[model samples]
Target: MPYDYKPYAYHRPPGLTAPEPRHKVAIVGAGPIGLAMALELAQHGVPSVIVDDNDVVSVGSRAICWSKRSLEILDRIGIGARCVEKGVTWKVGRTWHRDREVFTFDLLPEDGHKMPAFVNLQQYYVEEYLIEAAQANALIDLRFRNRVKAVEQAADHAVAVIETPDGDYRLEADWLIACDGARSPVRAMLGLDFDGELFEERFLIADIEMAADFPSERWFWFEPTFHPGQSALLHKQPDNIYRIDLQLGWNTDPEEERKPERVIPRIEKVVGHRDFRLDWVSVYTFQCRRLRNFVQGRVIFVGDSAHVVSPFGARGGNGGLGDVDALGWRLAGVVRGEAPEAALAAFDRERQFGADENILNSARSTRFMSPEDGVERLFRDAVLHLANRVDFARPMVNSGRLSRPCVYPLVAPDATGLPEVSRPGAVAPDAPLADGWLLERLGVGFTVLAIGCAAPEVPGARALALPVTPELAARYLGGAGAAVYLIRPDQVVAARWTACGVEEIAAALTASREGRT
Candidate 1:
């Protein structure tokens, strides 16, 4: 069944009648990224006002794949379990060349983590969950139908001119996060544009309601017999909806392709049946682009406003959550006067690194999927042909790299022989403890995870000591008998040591807070 979209009620703003107090943060665009940004800030006791031009959730099953890292981030903000329960969880991906199976990969072969490797929940569901959480939080003031028309940044604050149903009003905030999407009006107001590659290839995305007994695994085909000479992808979502992406060449007319007359036959060819209801259809060109810098004075860009990638890798939405993860705690610290404004530079630095990584992968996948008729095509066909029987060539198949958390390149404390999974600059690996999960105990703050040893007291950081279980030992301790780790508020490892003193742990914590790491 198609989702019923309900409009959120909008009320008159106090700023329409009188000047309002400055907000700690003002986020434009109430999409998944913007709403999640508000909720994440609220979790740190920082209030934010979210404004958007629309009142309803997204119309289609956009951004259906949520990575494990994104799930963990959502869990911290209080919606991970709901997303997991409602989403179609899958980890295995199969890639085929013509009628032959070429490559198969498992994203998560180990256990003990709280979230699955990936979940196929629609973007609208995620937005709805975040909106509900936002409405219940006192720190989040959601202003639906309030559109940001113009933005101006001062030395200490940013101001947005918003047009609402009642009247036009000015909103002031210490920081303005433009969670507004790919065609961000806020970014346009600031006269900034993305710089990267835009491929000539086009793809058709159709969400169809079907009652099929397909496994919840990602299936991709290269020049399949059904959709001859073109690539296709299939993913299962909740509500018996299936997401189908059929690669259409650059010459195909988007308007003509989107019509039901043109879409149904193509979908019928892939599914081998005409018994499907097309729910939503969209045609998009491939793009891998980003802003040179995500932060511009007091107005910062988050999500699609900062970067965009081809949809193949599931990087667009997941990368946005990465921005929220990196920025939320730092922005909260700055708002509460706990950290200097310079701390935001780290958010800008790390997320740019992440965006570049995503763009690189997305671009590579696009090139392979829609190769030109020369060397690119020759190489792609050769790889697919060789992959059918050879183990070495199977790794060369470029269906889509899939999304994973990018480890920030931070120069921090480190120790040899400890597990690389929990090394500095990486997200702390999750493991099972006696009572619950390791991430749940991390508690959205700096943590000293001492395994197989007593935890050292560090100011402004929680200490957790545990006898090493098999999973913990494998993920955190490696071959070492004991290990100590300094975890950042975002659950990223700031430092780790086979053994460390209290003073060293305290210094690492201070450095991480100050963005020195």
Candidate 2:
């Protein structure tokens, strides 16, 4: 059966009758990114108003792969465990050429982390979980059918003219985060545009319901006999539904191909049976693009509003989550006056760096998938052919490069001889702490995890001391003696040092809060 779609009820806005107080933060979309931002701000004691034109979760099964880093971010916002429980976890991905198997890779080669490498949950489910989380939080004021018609950003704040069933009204906020997806109204009102390449290839993506016991693994085929001279990808999702993506060259009419008459036969050839029911179908051409800058005055952009990439790399939503992970804390701190507003420039720089990385990876995989017929096809085929026989050539296979958390380039203080896993700029890795996970103990605040020393008395930061258990010692300590590690509110490692006294800890915290190197 096709997944049932339900819309949430909309009510009259409180501001319809009279003016309301300006919000500290206003988010302009109720998608996963915007809701997560609101919840994140709420966690930091910052309340926000979330306005959206739509009143439901996603209608399509778009963006099915959630990365581990995204899961970690979700964990902080209170939906991580629920998402994991409902999602189909998979780490092994296999690639094939024609009839021969070529390469296979395991994304999660290690353990001790709270989340898996990837989880196959539909975008709608994720949004549902996020909405539930936001609704449960008292700080988030969700307004459905409240469409943002115009936006004006000033030196100190932004004002959005929103239209609702009742009437139009002005919504003022110290900062406005746009999560309005690929076609962002905020971006248009500000007269800004994305800069990057738009690919010429088209693809047919479908969700089919079947009881087949296909293992939970990503299977990609290049020039398979069932779909000769093109690429096909299959992923198992929850509820016995599978997502299949097939390449359709530039000449193919998307409308004609989307018809059930055309789609069912193509799927039948691949599955070798007519026992499946089609749930949803979409034809799309992807782009790898991003804004010139994510932070523009008092208006900020997150998720698809900030950048977009091809599905092959799973970078689309995952990249947006990265924006959420990086922006939430900085914006929260600035709103509360705990940090200078100049720190937003650092968020702009680091997230752009991450966007560039996603674009580069997605573009390369796309080129490999839809290579030109002459030398490009020859070289691609040669690589795929050689991959079957040699280990060295296997890495050349370009199934969508899976999404991973990007480590920003930060010049914060660091202690030499420490393990590189928990380096500055990277997310503080998850580990076991007695009966619970290490992250739960750290909480959502600036933290100093002191090992081999007494906990420091740093103002405005939480301090936790840990004895060197074998696992903690290996992952965090690594025989580097007693060290003090500073963690950001977003749980990123700000700095670490063996002899980081209170003065140095305060300096690292200052640099981190100020967004300086």
The per-model lDDT (C-alpha) reads 0.93, 0.90
What tens digits encode model 1's per-residue C-alpha lDDT throughout 325-436?
A: 9999999999989898889988988999999999999999999998889999999999998987889998889898999999888898898988778878899988877788
**Every model: Cα RMSD to truth:** 0.9, 1.3
Which residue segments of model 1 deviate by more than 4 Å?
none
Span of ten consecutive residues with least summed lDDT in model 1? 508-517
- Each candidate structure's TM-score, on Cα atoms with residue i matched to residue i, is 0.99, 0.97
lDDT of 2 at 151: 97
Please give, for residues 1-517, the per-residue lDDT of candidate 2 as tens digits: 6677788889898788888798899999999889888988888888999999998888889989999989988988899898899999999999999989999999988778888999999999999988988888889999989999999988999999999988999999999999999999889999999999999999999899988988999999998999999999999999888999999988899999999999999998777785899999999997899999999999999999999899898998888888888888888889888889989998999999999999999998998999877998898989998998998888888888888878878899888899998889888888887778888888878899987788898987999998777778877888777788999987889999888579889888888888996
Index of the highest-TM-score prediction: 1
RMSD of 1: 0.9
